[model samples]
Target chain A: MTKTLAIDCMGGDYGPSVIIPAAISALQQHSDLKIYLVGPQQELQQHLKQSPDFGNRLHIQDACEVIGMSEKPSTALRRKPNSSMRKSLELVRDGHADACVSSGNTGALMALATVLLGTLPGIERPAITAELPNRKGTVTNMLDLGANIDASAEQLTSFAIMGHVFSQLADDVEHPRVALLNIGEEAVKGRDSIKLASDILSNQSQIDYVGYIEANQIYDGNVDVIVCDGFTGNNVLKACEGITRFLYDQLKTEFTSNWWSKAVSAMVWPILRRFQRRINPDQYNGASLLGLREIVIKSHGSADSKATLFAINKAITEIERQVPQAIQDQVAQLLLNTDNEDEE
Target chain B: MTKTLAIDCMGGDYGPSVIIPAAISALQQHSDLKIYLVGPQQELQQHLKQSPDFGNRLHIQDACEVIGMSEKPSTALRRKPNSSMRKSLELVRDGHADACVSSGNTGALMALATVLLGTLPGIERPAITAELPNRKGTVTNMLDLGANIDASAEQLTSFAIMGHVFSQLADDVEHPRVALLNIGEEAVKGRDSIKLASDILSNQSQIDYVGYIEANQIYDGNVDVIVCDGFTGNNVLKACEGITRFLYDQLKTEFTSNWWSKAVSAMVWPILRRFQRRINPDQYNGASLLGLREIVIKSHGSADSKATLFAINKAITEIERQVPQAIQDQVAQLLLNTDNEDEE
Candidate 1:
């Protein structure tokens, strides 16, 4: 069966410029993939016209309204009925598309996804997972990246299970080592919620639960999945981005300064490009909103064509993997066990 | 009076290897400064014997006990009498030394400082301030970097004041702009604690308070002082360090693998060195534990000789500026104003 990805073309900073071309590019590269572009039909079509002979594979879904980056998520969702983000999600909910991708307001997409597709059974909250590039060629999936700010122990446990399944399916890590992000490696060193969640995860037999991982150990690639509350995850992600930008700016200043340094920079340009490809945020463009019945990829709002194409490809992968079905089955078994324990 | 810096010679990973040489280097640069090295006299003397003319400027106090990094901080203080960390703080508390510097367990240091030196009159909790290198040449002081995990609104307000004072003293900024770290730039975006703190800071006439600062805006060099709870601050610090290390490793791989890249790396070595000096953590090694009666600089445990020397220098600067007195005076006025308002 051909996989169709619903792209929210009106979402993100350079919306159509990035999203349209990205969709066209991905569609051309993956012959089995189709894209349903959800945005202002006229504008999206105009952008798509620039690409050669891609009309057959690309479809447009008219979405008259757009969600502004600064708009309050809940208010925007309720008021804007025809928003591109909302339309894109509806396509997934109604089974018109296999997955949905948006680079707009994160909170709004989360709310809309939960409201439309609903969370999987036994999952209290749906978590957003972003792939962090480690020293190894593989990536570590970090969850709850600004999805639920105040998470209970139960919610955290659910996140771990979902993250484990997603990693196994999406990243193809067998028996993925799931860890709780704590202040220290010891199980006793964190807040009450962390301590309780650690206990729950330890008791669960389904996951290869690593005791705890500190923030400093994040780059060590000791764990396949690192789980935390949305607040901490968001702060960590932003901090990493901030430091990367800081270093890049510092390096740029160094290379452009003197004659000898410029000579050196010219020689290392290819190697630097290779390094950029590995760790660049644009490469790992989409973060999956896991535990939803349908797959949803949240792209960066400031993404260029390269990043948007990466997001579209992510949606295609999710559909092909049948990640949602795998999640649903795992959650169903967990719910059954919980019900049995309660009866006992 | 000659400034005396009490060094916790037994605190860090390499102990005397790094700290002793760093102290000697500091003395070499600043002849006016005297060093009170607190550790086991035999070990310290052995290390001191390696440096010529060290006896004239160095004094050794016998502290047989040492605080391990993994020791329970609360239990370590009550159990280990004459511990190096405790004795070092005692020197400042009794006015034997002008300032104290340690690379020991951060929790133990904060606890000992609070117990021995005590907080300023109106300050409820002490704050830890870390200097973050901005894109520009100047640095911004970020606080409560793991001093207090849970902070009240009043404590946050005081943190802003202390951070502002710290930046001014350390960075020589005339009117430092203080900003509260929040999830969003809007006034209503954060929790009640942040909102209340923002309200209190905006009304305070003594400090130059900028509005809320998002994590993305931290490196923009717009604010001289960034204030938040210890949990958030610690996480941010660790995350930034992780990313920096990751990027550095990636760059090293790019520059060393091939002959072409190696030639470029050699040519760019001068420029890279300049850039490295700008963002070097060694340049900003010490973090002041503010609100104490005496100055204390927390050096990194993994610090090299250069970083250790920088911490000692920071301690001397704090003593010279009389930062504690400035903070005490400001806090006392704030308390008096609160009392007057209550009377009305």
Candidate 2:
């Protein structure tokens, strides 16, 4: 089936320079994919002219306004009615596109998506679920990366339900293993909020709750889904980025220090490249807004052309799998089974 | 001047096996250091028998009860009156030891330290502060790594004040640059509590507040002290550990996969070892329970002998610098200023 995507070309840091090329790369990879590039017409025209792949399948939708990277979500929502981010989300809401991809202000993107596409039944707040390569070469789907801060126990359980559905659709995992992010793996550890969420998750037959997983164990790839409140999820995601950059920077400095070390570094460069490729987080650049009524992928705002391509491909995969429908079905089933679970 | 340290030899994953040897090594390194080993006398004697550095300075303080790793802080406080953890904290409170180092349940350590030593004047709650390697070959001190959850806006500013004092005293950093850990560097980014804390930090003349810092920039080492509430602190600390281990593991596996790679690895092994030593987080172990009346360092529960020695050194350094007294003075000064800081 043909899949149409709405790309927010003006949203990311690099604007048309990086995103347009990424859209071109996506079209080349998925021959049947159609993209509606939403941005300023002249700017999008210049980039499209540079690419040989522009055709009728590649439609251009001009948007007059944009949401700045540092703009407040509330302000953007009230002010920028013609923003590329809003226009792209509108495409998905109006059934013109199967999915939407944006590299825009995270808060604005989330606010606009929630207002336009609404949310699946039983999901009070939408979440941002992103994948990162783990030790076992399998990806871990961690959710609520920045969507909702101080999430309640019921909301955490809802996140688990959505994450479990994602693992099944994206990774084809049976009885997808799930775990809550905590300070310690022990039950008596973390704060009261985490303890409450544990009770809810433990009783859910639909989610294979594998107990708590610590931050150090996140990349172990033992669990398919890791759920947490937005504060924790956002910090964990950024901390990983900080450490990865430090290691690579240190290794580079070590290699180029002296002539003797440089000779050895040249010899080992290929092996190091292989190591880098295996652990590069850029390949996992896109995150789907999981509990939304329609699929919307948020690309890293600072992503390069290659990373942006990976995010677009993520959207293609979600469209093919009908991820929104799958999540809605699972959540409806969970809500239908009336269980007066303990009041958290 | 001589410094006395109380070691909870019964605590940690390896118990006396790692702690006793580490104490002996610390004694050898610091001739003026005295260590009171708190544990069952017979077991501590058996471990001490292997170390040749034991002398009059190495005294054993017997504590019959042991706090299990899984024991709850509150329960252990009520049940185990003679626990090694309690005894170590008592030694500091009674002035028998200038500082205490424990590798027990973090919650138990924090609880016992707060109850026995009490908070310094103007300090509401105690916090755990530790360091991690940064890209600049220096370390970043992050605090409240699980000691205090849901910290108020005023409490966050107080954490910054304590961390700033620590940076100056421990690292000899003059006018130490401080930053509030947030999701973004922008002033309007992060939640209400964080924004409130930022306002307090910015207006304070005593602190060199560098504004907000994101997680991905933690290793950049631009700021000396990074402050946050316990939840974000714990998650960020652990996330760094997870990513570091993953990268190192991947690099090792890549270097040893085949004969050709092994040959290249052998040539670069020396350089890799040098790089590892420079960035090894083990050297940064030993978290001080700041804001308390007495100095207490929490060693990593799974620390090996070498890591424990480093932690002991940390305690010794704090004792020499009179960290508790320094914090007490600064906090009292801040309180005397009579600012109506917005109620959290």
Candidate 3:
């Protein structure tokens, strides 16, 4: 019943300062969890001395080189062969850890994950998947959040299959409804790639493919899973982050305008704060690199202790569900069906 | 100075019901404005009977057909040559109206606008440009919002130039700062097209191009104009709209959760309502098809009268600034300079 997670302590903006505390907090919450802090031993040791029995539950794995937040994936892979990012992923690949969590450069993490764990049987590329808060008080899974741009029709269908399996585990939903992200809901709308993907997904009887959903309906939460290429996915994700921050910033500016407003703010601050917490991007920090041979979660680079802790919990849940096996079964079936049709 | 606006009254979800009322309101606000309502005369007469001396400011041009909200651009162009959308654009081309506004299918509108108005010299394609609310009170202009997808590096550079001229007119900010929208703000990041466009933009001395901007900083209001290809632009626009609406919907749900919560809402409803109005997507309804030889604005297909009226006002503003001529002059200079360099 024990789950093990490899943490890239040298990743993200805060590096070990955020990662070490987050790992300790996660250990306290999960009784049957063990963590391997992968980074320069001295940097992690400085923070490890802060907590009692920290060395007992936590293990250290030394990685000499660290990838910068903005470093190119190819260069990082070539130059930082012994990076914490690579070491953490290697642990997952070798079955030393049940899963790996990193807040490193997204491109670098994706590149390292692909090389180390490979991909699913039929999946050409592993999509980056994450849950987003929606209007229905339930979460919706969105994929390819900046891993690969211009994903082909076949790749998009693979993303839907991967997301369908992910929603079952992450959201605990049966027959998860899947939809393609587009500019309009009409079947006749969008580019040729989306149209081709729609045709392929619709033919799969097992897939609860509910046709197209526009970007404007993303948070409506009508569907459990939303699939798109990395270009649109990245733009949509960042746009949401930008608007959420803007709305709260506007409220802060409005509340401090006058004494009357300030009094009103005091009375409603608690409810407003709660609403803010629900919509915060940091609360939904872990983004799974779905379709990989092994489970690998990408945490936000700017994640603090609380966000990083949430990411750890996400990884643990993914491990508990045995996500890789579920995806493999689904992908294998899909590929077999495709092969049969090709021969005919 | 008086200005004339031609409106496709049969466009959008509400059709004549929303467009007529909105036209009356806009005409009332702008005392020196003339309106040409391009649609069936029967619908116009029914609505005009309500207003006193409606015939004084409003003119009716009968069009027997319409393009559906989801109609393909090519199909609509071929089938509905007598559509109100086409008639409205024709008014602008014939110099009968200073500007034209439509709430028809975006694809149809863009296609019609391009054919009717033609692209400016050196401009490859006319981009669908719109203003968005940002952290600062001022608006940021975003272009290529699904007018054309997969824009070349040269087209993107042209968008920046077109957007720069638009900002100077619509926003009234001289030397407006422009930035390319990418996954990351770093210079070395993004696809080849975006990188090539960024390089070209940075070299243009007159552009005030400020390198790259990621989606997270979109609402930060750091740049005056945000430029991207149609695909990313459309997705980003819809994403922001989706989040803005989602937050408001969540707030409404939260406030009505319990009697105690209802009591809290009663006291804070005024402030909350104000915030909702300020961030409403309807308030920023008009999307101008930039790079065209004449001014043509595309209103949201689902726009109500309030939003439609805002779109009318948007056309008036463009008319006052002669936006098309301004862009034409700027683009002409750049092309002539390029031609001179080739000769050298």
Candidate 4:
């Protein structure tokens, strides 16, 4: 089956320089994939490499305006209708592309996507979900990462359902163990919304609810899906990013503190490089906008060409698996039915 | 000045075995510091070593009960009035000890400490504050780590003031830079409460408010104090713990992957050891229960003897610096004065 993705060419720090190479490589890697480069037509065409696959599979949809990285979502939605970010999502919404990938301003993308594509039947809001590399060499999918800051009990339940389906499709886990991200594992811990969500999830026969798991247990790889409010999830994810950078800097300082240590560092550089590759963020760069009617993946704003390729691959995988449809089915079966049962 | 600490000998994973040795070492290190081992008399005495300082400075406070790690705070407060955790706080309240150090159940310890010692003037709830090592080789003091889960704007403002005072005294940063932990650095990014707290903090003449900061910039060493609601702070801290463990395990696996990598890892083991020691949690073990009328330090529940010593030292420092008194003065000068100004 052929998969088509709309690529935002004017997004991210490096813009088309990094994204064009990544799109070219993605096309070369997957013969059945087609990409629509949505940005300024002249600029995007100038960076494109002359390949036999260029006109056949890769096409450019000109977008005149570009959204600033720090622009407000409402302002961007109102003023920048011709932005590469907006055009990319429009491609997916108009059924011209199966999915969209961008490294644009997160808030703007979320607002535009919600307004343009809407959400699944039972999901009132869309969540930004991502995969974190766990200790078991697998990935743990966490959701509501800065999308809905103060989520209610019902919104949290929706997150858990979306995360559950995402893990099954993305990570290929047979029966993904779902858990609430709380401060403690005890039943009485966390805020009232989390406890209420736990109660609602416990009654669901579809989700393999494993109760509450704290942030310290998130990377242990025992649980597959971790659900939390966007406030907590965003803070936790960024804290992990901070700590990773801290350790990397600390290691570099230690290995170059003295002449003898520097020499030893040179000799052991290969092993260190291998270790770096094992936990590199580029290998897992895409954050899927879950609950949206059309698939949209957000690449890290500072991602390089390699990381962008990973993001492109992620969108292809979601398109192949029909993630949005799958989430709709599961949510309709679990949540809407549960609501009806509660009323009865 | 002579500083005395009441150590809960029955707390933490190793209990008396770890606490007794840490107490002995602390006594040997600081000649003027006195300690009271608060626990079962017979069990505490059995773990003691033969030392001349035992009778002169280290005394025993016989508390017959012990609180379980997983016990509810309300249950422990009502049923275990004579618990070692409670006895330690009581010692501080009754002026028998200048401060107290406990590696007990955090929720139980916080409840007992707040009830026995009370909150300082203008402070309604105590927050758990801890130092995280940053890239600049200094520490960033973050607060409200699981004390009040759903903190209000007033509560968050209180946290900023307390954190500012704590950083000045503990980290020795004159006019410490303070920031509210948010998802984005933009003014319109976070929730309404955080926005209100930001407004309150900005108006305070005492606080060196530097506006908002994202969690990814936390370890950059650019800010001295980061304030957030307890739920976000707790999850962020624990997520850092999770990522640290994850990277360490990944590095270990990479180094032992093959004979060549193993030999190289062995060759560079000393540099790696130094790097590990630089970022070791033992160097920074204690989390201060700030905003209390009296000083109390809670050690990590799984801390070994070395880590416990750091917790004891933290309590001694706070006692010497009069942290609670400083916080009281600041809160009075900032919060109370601001309220009066608002009314006028």
- Report the poorest 10 consecutive residues by lDDT, candidate 2 chain B: B335-344
Ranking by DockQ: 2, 4, 3, 1
Q: Provide TM-scores for the models.
A: 0.94, 0.97, 0.97, 0.96
Model 4 lDDT per residue over A1-344, tens place: 88999999888899999998999899989989999999999998788745455666989999999998878899879998799999999999999999999998889999999999999998988999999989887899998887888899989999998998889888888899999998888887778999999998888678899999989998999999999988889889888887888898888888888998888888778887877788787888999999999999999989999999999999999988999998888888888767766676
Clashes counted in candidate 3 amount to: 0
Chain A accuracy as TM-score for every candidate: 0.95, 0.97, 0.97, 0.96
Error of 1 at B97 (Å): 1.4
Candidate with top DockQ is 2
Q: Considering summed lDDT, which 10 consecutive residues are worst modelled in model 4 chain A?
A: A47-56
Candidate 4 residue runs with Cα over 4 Å from true position: A49-53, A336-344, B49-53, B336-344
lDDT for position B231 in model 1: 78
For candidate 2, what is the lDDT?
0.87
Every candidate's CA RMSD: 2.6, 1.9, 1.6, 2.0
Cα deviation of B123 in candidate 3 (Å)? 0.8
For model 1, how does the per-residue alpha-carbon lDDT over B1-344 read when each residue is reduced to its tens digit? 68888999988789988999999999999878888899999999898776868555778889999998877678667999889999998988888899999998888898888998898877888999988888776888899888887688888988987887677777889999999887667654666898898887776667788888878767878899998888778888887777777788778888787887887777766776787677777788888999988899999988999999889988888888899998888668766664565456
**For residue A331, what is the lDDT in candidate 2?**
76
Question: What is the alpha-carbon lDDT for the whole of candidate 4?
Answer: 0.89
Worst 10 residues of 3 chain B by lDDT: B335-344
Model 4, first chain, TM-score of 0.96
The per-prediction i-RMS, to one decimal, reads 1.9, 1.2, 1.3, 1.1
